[model samples]
Target: MSEDTETVSVHGREFQRTSLDEGVYYAPVAFDDREESRLTAQHEIVSRIFGDGLFSPRIPVGEPEAILECGYGGGDWAVQCADEFEDCEGMRVRRLSSRPMSRQMDRPENLDLVAHNLNDPLRDPEIFKANHYDLIHSRFVFPGIKSGRWNGYIRDMRLLLRPGGWVQIMEYLPIIQSHNGRLTDQNAVRRWWQEYQGAMADMDRDPRIGRRLKRLLLDNRYRDVEVDIVQLHIGDWSKNETQASIGRDSVEMIGDLLESLGLWPFTSKLGWTAARFEDLMQEVRAELQNVELNLYIEL
Candidate 1:
């Protein structure tokens, strides 16, 4: 890892420059493979963008021979890309609080995991020089940005990307799922979405960050960029067995994120009392118990 990294603190969570591994993000006590599957799903979206040819898009002379990923929340995508595009360098950002680099670099591979607080503007705001990088990728980065320093997200990407270099921002549209393709209470779901959308608008994080990416690329001076709203169905919710299991697990994941950052102290206006929230969550879980599968975004 590079020694020239910076650190910052916001919303009580500290950000540091460090590399990542499975054990850092995933709890050592958890036995499930959900995180593993989530990483696979993200790569599938990238694969769809790459089409059937070699990983590298035809590039003009003097372009950097590497790709950069802004917030490598999970390192799996970089690992997969390294396996696929052996010649391209895959870049990733690491939290400052993570484990030592010596342990992570023990495995010899082409991928370079760096230690850098990605949102620090003064520290080479533009990661790669102008016209550098064949492609730049970032995903699931907004939740972290809510703490502060939002502009750094766009500015860094714009400054780092080489002219004509492709930049792809794949983000999830925040949505609370319902089993059986029917909202448990249409009013409740609608209310949740309206308020959620309004919050995102205020934060400048587009709800359709995935679909709006084309416009973002254009606005940021990227040429020939395209965005797709890819909706993935995890399971067939109509089948009772599947939906119930997913519903239970999905609610648990949201609870985990909320509690992880100590965020529950701020959401009282939503009418979510401890008991009421559990009841509602259990309702969704029960709804899933009767259904076979479910669909949701990663946000």
Candidate 2:
């Protein structure tokens, strides 16, 4: 970590904060052990939602020789993908992240972790050469990337992709809705979401980036762009056992996200007191536990 990026303690939790001029990384959440665990669990939940697949079947490539994952929090996806293609000859899985990764004894040999900021161009041209990657993937990275820089981010990723290479981006819609029309104006979750979206927009981060990804790719001249929507039920409302289990896990994940993702932006950017934010979250959690509400989020 550089002087531009420093850890600050807030509400007894340590969070990484960046100078506005740095433009390397900016997120409300902390990049600590708890966050790492949450990210890994989130990866598993998302993988299960997509049938445990790493990439879409529609992707043209087969057994990609070179893979790149941008904003790979905890490197969970990269590590798993590397393990999946470990036997393939000349296979390489490169992960780009702002956080420094400690050496893992069980790390896959084909996986390479790089500390780089997504907001800026690749620092090392030799390593991140043009047309070098077979596939470029990112998930939930919009929060850290400035709204004005999305075009450059896409262009840079395009530059790194080999001919006919595919880029997969997964993001949350950042709004929670009720499938049964039970969510109302009085709901704390809905209020919180509205304020959160405004705060993010004020910070130049697009809260609805998930819905715009296809347009972004198309505008970037990418072909065969496909968008997949995954519905995440918050509580144990599903009739199916697997879906119910996933819902339970989602409740926990969303709770963690409410605190980690909302704390800084809510208090600092939105002028909310810490106590006010905490009270709002308590109400939001209560609402999330109501299965009859049928709350869900789109990804």
Candidate 3:
């Protein structure tokens, strides 16, 4: 409700404007309580992927002076890190590679939220002092990062980290795999990804960069880099209760996100009419409900 904030509704889904991205045409996700609620659920789903903890084992154990979270949406993970390490400094950047959500959480005194674009140069000593951070984490941001800039991003993370500082990222492969080989051109999942990836390709972003993170990190001179892949079931088809719950949520989340993920990319870049997009979405939704499909996403 700030004077600077404006709400924009597209196809009934609302987005708030805190500030325009580096590209004037692109705006981050809305900064509303409802958006925060969605981000909270997303954080839960992500936490389950890392064994229900905010800090991953791949990250170093002991607390350091400063920590940075790239693409911190809703500020949930940053706030949790601040609470756990009250004495440590927690810094979060908005709109790096995720939807921009609210930064108005009741965070601890140690946590600082700032609006920053990660695509910019990090080697600039004035902006990011070299070798300053102890730990850095980014999740699910590969979609927003341009393909050519991945190396620059890795270099920035490496330069910003202090000696032996750890960096961890979690991203998912865009392609959906089905055990039954049901993800054909006739199926919704494959069709959706085809359109989705095509649109991202138009924007020069690679949606399937999850499997290459380890190589990128090692090539960038990051020591002890680790990649952990978690597969999410498409529906409530898992024997384990926790994973089943995550799967159920995942299905709902995908249903909810179909528009946000595809609207602009498919319409503006790929020439998808609204009606055609809606029909495609419906097809994808139908496939999501098929328990026999056994579709999975690798993260």
Q: What would the TM-scores of all predictions be?
A: 0.57, 0.90, 0.87
lDDT of 1 at 78: 56
* Alpha-carbon local distance difference test for all models: 0.44, 0.77, 0.70
Across residues 199-253, which tens digit of lDDT does each residue of candidate 2 receive?
A: 8888888878888888888898988888888789898898988888899889878
Model 2: lowest-lDDT 10 consecutive positions: 21-30
Give the winner by lDDT: 2
Per-candidate RMSD vs. true structure? Answer: 7.9, 2.5, 3.0
lDDT of 1 at 154: 61
Higher-lDDT candidate among 2 and 3? 2
Scored by TM-score, the top model is 2
Q: For residues 264-299, what per-residue lDDT tens digits would candidate 3 score against the true structure?
A: 677667887878888988888888888788877788
Instruction: Flag the better candidate by lDDT, 1 or 3.
Output: 3
lDDT by residue for model 1 (1-299), tens: 33222222323332332211211221111111343343444455445434432132433323336677665544655556555566544433222213222223222266666644544552454434554566676666554343335444565667766566666566666564643466544434334456555544554344555554565556656565554554433334434554334434444444333232122222332334556544544544443343343544443
Error of 1 at 151 (Å): 6.0
Error of 3 at 78 (Å): 1.4
Candidates, ranked, TM-score: 2, 3, 1
TM-score (C-alpha, index-matched) for candidate 3:
0.87
